[model samples]
Target: MPELPEVETTLRGIKPHVAGQCLRGAVVRVQKLRWPVPPNLSELVAGQTVDDITRRGKYLLLHLTGQTLMLHLGMSGSLRIVPDEIPVGKHDHVDLLLDGKRLRLTDPRKFGAVLLLDHDPYASPLLAGLGVEPLSAELTGDGLRSRARGRFVAIKNFIMDQKVVVGVGNIYASEALFRSGINPLRACNSLDSKEWNRLVGDIRHVLTEAIAAGGTTLQDFTGSDGRPGYFRQELRVYGREGEPCSRCGAAIVQEKIGQRSSFFCPDCQK
Candidate 1:
C-alpha cells in the first residue's frame, strides 16, 4: 500500500499542475473501487477549481471551494500525469481532465478509493480519527512518551498505529526503529525519555529522507510522474533480512510484529 511518504510525494508532484486548475472534465472509467466511486462525482467536481492538494496519513485530499475529494492509493494504485489524449490503460480507473492535461488514477488491484466529501474532510470518519502527522511539531518526544504510558504494545506496532501517529508504515517503522537503536519488540511503556527523544528524531529523519527520495518503491509504488523511488537503496534493514547489518556487520534479522514484517539489526538495535 502507498504509505505517508509516497502519498505526500504524490501530493507534491501533482499539486503544482492540479492546484488552482479548474476541472474541465471528470471521467470514471470504472465506478467500483475499494468503495464505490461516488456516483455523480463528475457532476460534483467538474466545474470546480482545485484550491489545494494535501495529504492526511496515506490519503490525498483535493480541496475545492465547497467540497473535497479524498483518495487512497491502496495496495497498487498510483496517480500520474499524462496527456489528455493518451489512451487509457487497462488499470486506468479515473481521470480528471484539466487544462488539456490529465491527472489519472491507475489501480491494477482496484483497491483504491475516491470519496466526495461535502463537509470538512478532516472531520470525515476516514480522516478524523487519524493521529498526529509524524513530521508535525505536535509529534514531539514528550508527546510520544505521554501516549506510550501503560501501553504494552510493541514499539513497532505502537508507532504503526494510525491513532498514535499516522503514516509510519511497515517499512519506515522498521527503518526508524533501527535508526533509533530500539528493538522492535520493546514494549511501548519501556521507553525512557532519552529513548523517546531518539525515536522522535529518527522517525522525522527517516520520513523526511524517504519523502525527499520520493518514498520507497517496494513493488508497485511510484511517484505521481510514474517514477520509482530511490529510498530503497538507502534502507538499512527493512528488506535486508539475513544480510549484514549496515552498522555492526552482524546479520540483520526479520520477525513478525502485528503480522507485518519487522526488520532490524539484532546486534545494533536494542
Candidate 2:
C-alpha cells in the first residue's frame, strides 16, 4: 500500500498539473473500486475548477467549485498526467479530463477509491476520526506520551493506529523505532518521557527524509511523473531481515508484531 510519504510525493508531483485547471468532467472507464466510483462523478465535477489540492493522511483532496473529490491510491494505485491522445493501459481506471490533458488513475487491484463529496471533506466519515498528521505541529512528544499512558499494546501497534497518529505505516514505524533505539515489542506504556521525545523526533526525521526522497519504492508505488522513489537506498532496517545492523554489526531481527512484519536490530534497539 502507498504510505504517507508516497501520497505526499504524489500530491506534490501532481499538484502543479491539476491544480487551478478547469475540470471539464471525467471519463470513468471502470466504476468499481474499493468503493464504487460515484456514478455521476463527471456530472458532479462538470464545469468546476480545481481551486487547490491538499492531502490528509493518505487521501488526496481536490477542492473544486462546490465540492471536493477525494482520491485514495489503494494497495497498488498510481496517478499520471498525460495528454488526451495517450492510449489507456490495462490498469487505467479513471481519467479526470482537463484542457487537452488528463489526470489518470491506475489501480491494478481495484482497491483505490474515487469519491465526490458535496460537503466539508474534513467532516466526512472517511477523514472525520483521523489522527493528527505526523508532520504537523500537532504531533508532540508529550501528546504521544499522554496517548500511550496505561496502554499495554505493543509500541509499534500503538503508533500505527490511525486514530492515534496518521500515516505511520509498517515500514516507517519499523524504521523509526529502529532509529530511536526502541524495540517494537515493548509495551506502549513502557516508554518514558525521554523515550517518547526521541521517538517523536525520529519519526518526524524519518518521514521528512522519506518524503524528500520521493518515497520508498518497494513495489508498485511511483510518483505522478511515473518515477520510482529512491528512498529504499537509505533504508536502515525495514526489510533487511538477517542483515548486518549498521550501528552495532549485529544481525537485524524480523518478527511479527501486531501481525505486521517488524524489523529492528536486537543489539541496537533494547
Candidate 3:
C-alpha cells in the first residue's frame, strides 16, 4: 500500500503536468473499483478547469471548478501521466482527459477508488475524523504524550492508529521506532517525556527523508514517474532483518506486531 511519502511524491510529480489544465473529459473504463467509481463522475467533471492538486494523508485531491475529486491509491494501485494516444493496459480503470496530456489510474487488485463530491470535501466521511497529519505542527511530543497517557497498547500500534496520527504505516512506524532507539514492544504509557520527545523528532525526520527520497519501494509501490524510491538504501532497520546492526554489530531480528513485520536491533533498541 502507498503511504504518506508516496502520496506526497505523487502530488508533487503530477502537479506540474495537470495543474491549470482544462478537463476535456473523463472516462470510466471500469466502474467497479474499491468503492465503485462514482456513476456520475464523468459528466460532473467534464469541461471544468483544475484548480490545484494536493494530498491529505494518503488520498489525492483534485480541486476542480465546483467539486473535488478524491482519489485513494489502495494496495497495488498507481497513477501515471501518459500520452492520450497510449493504449490502456489490462488493469487500467479510469482516465482523466486533459487538453494536452492524460492521467490514468491502474490498480491490479481493484482496491483503489475515485470519488466525486460537490460539498465541502473536508466534511466527507472519507476525510472526516482523520488524525492530525504527521508532518503538521499539531503533531508534537507533548501532543503525542497526551494521547498515549494511560494507554497500554504497544507504542508501535499506538502511533500506527489512524485516529491518533495519520500516515504512520507499518514500515514507517518500524523505521521511526528504530531511529528513536525504542523497542517496538514498549507499552505506550511507560514512555516518559524524554522518550516522547525523541520519538516525535525521529518520526518527523524519517518521514521527511522518505518523502525527499520519493518513498520506499517495498513491494508494489512506485512513484508516479514509475521510478523506485532511493530511501530503501538508507534504511537502518526496517528491512535488514537477520543482518548486522550498523550501530552495535548485533543481529537485527524480526517479529510480528499487529500482524506487521518489525525489524529492529535488539541490542541497540532497548
Top lDDT model: 2
Candidate 2, 1-270: lDDT as tens digits:
688999999999999999999999999989999989988888889899999999998899999989999999987999989999999998999999999999999999998999998889999999999998999999998999998888899999999998899988999999999999999999999999999999999999999999999998988788999899999988999899989999999999899997898999999798
Which candidate leads in TM-score?
A: 2
Question: What is candidate 1's local distance difference test score?
Answer: 0.90
Pick by TM-score: 2 or 3, better one: 2
Worst 10 residues of 1 by lDDT: 38-47
- Cα deviation of 8, candidate 3, in Å: 0.6
> Which runs in model 2 stand beyond 4 Å of their true positions?
none
RMSD per prediction, one decimal? 1.2, 1.1, 1.4
* Model 3 alpha-carbon miss at residue 198, Å: 0.7
The RMSD (Cα, Å) of candidate 1 is 1.2
What lDDT tens digits, residue by residue, belong to model 1 across residues 183-262?
99999999999999999999999999998999889888889888999899999998899999988999999899889988
TM-score of 2: 0.97
Clashing pairs in 2: none
